[model samples]
Target: MNKVSMRFLMSMMLIVGGYAFAKAQSAQSLLKEVDSKVKSYKNIAIDFKYALSNEAQGVNQETKGNVVLKGDLYALNLLGTKQIFDGASIYTIVPEDEEVTISAVSDQDENAITPSKMLSFFNDGYIQKMDITQKVNGRTIQYVKLTPMDSNSEVKHTLLGIDTTTKHIYRLIIVQKNDTKITITVNSFKANQPMSANAFVFDESKYADYYINKI
Candidate 1:
């Protein structure tokens, strides 16, 4: 090769390398951007539709409902089924048996799906890998798959579908060790809205014939 040709090739390669470096964004930067967006809201409330499939339990349940969530309290309501927590107690209403199952706050299985516990997840994970882009939902998304580094945790893997437009968690899919899949899709949301204490408190004194099951 001629000296002139070799010089030109080296210059072209440097130019291309610089361009690529300038274009690529860092993983931390992408997660920081999403974090900034999420931080805009002090608290969150969303109306979601959820599907839970527990292969071990042989349970497949699809419940269309709105969940009102804040710190310590979360209330989930479907057309008929209702679940509420007043921070210390969890009350699940079973209309089929006409009773509300009241269980104390502990290491119960139902605590994993409680609204308060799940929302705390946003502050918990570090982005192992992140590629930011737009999805069919029209929100700018940081489509990330996470492995829970916490061994004592109930959730195994989490797939977050964040809304770029709203900059909030649009969809959260949680997979457990027992092959139980819980997917919560946020249809709409409001932040810092006034929710009654009664909203998280299940009052079933009115329903006399209902049966209560404690876990």
Candidate 2:
């Protein structure tokens, strides 16, 4: 190719490369900002709707849940079950079975999804790209897509929707390798809410009839 043609091609490539770099950097910065805003809250209470579906399998399910988070501690109520994390041990209470399972927290488990992880899990092991922005209910929501670095991961990718004005998470969509999709939509979010002193503490007295299985 002539010098002029080669130079034009190189210039085009440079522009495209620069744009990609800037887009990636913007996605990271926006996610970090959201994390900062979430961590600043003393406590947070969120009511959410969860939906899971697999079109190929004809499986569909929907549920509503709520969670209260304070630092690394969290209390989640879902499917008639309650899970509490006291920063050390995780207490999972199953009322239908009248049992409670206690286990140690394993931060090294990358596949585990907890309230804290939901906020900052994209910090590592993923390539983030700024996806799209949409207006819903008079608010602007910006989405970021994260593809796992591990090819063996069951999850194909995850999309996080953040409220641009409040920097709070609005939704999370997890697309699995098998084409199963799980979407969690935040119905309501309350930050810095006043929580009881023992919100994250599992009181056995409340479930006296339940079996306490400590592992």
- TM-score winner among the candidates? 2
Best by lDDT: 2
Evaluate residue 172 in candidate 1 and report its C-alpha lDDT on the 0 to 100 scale.
77
- Residue clash pairs of candidate 1: 98-210, 98-211, 99-210, 99-211, 139-164, 140-164
- Residue runs of model 1 more than 4 Å from their true location after superposition: 1-43, 52-62, 78-80, 109-113, 125-127, 131-134, 150-156, 176-180, 213-215
Each prediction's TM-score against the native? 0.67, 0.94
Given candidate 2, what's the lDDT at residue 85?
93
Per-candidate clashes come to: 6, 0
Tens digits of lDDT, candidate 2, 93-145: 99899999998886337475677687778788999999999999999999999
What's the true lDDT of residue 69 in model 1? 69
For 78-147, candidate 1 gives per-residue lDDT tens digits of: 7687778888888878676677878888757643445665554544543344434556645566565666
Output the lDDT of residue 122, model 1: 45
Model 2 TM-score, 2 decimals: 0.94
lDDT of 2 at 20: 95
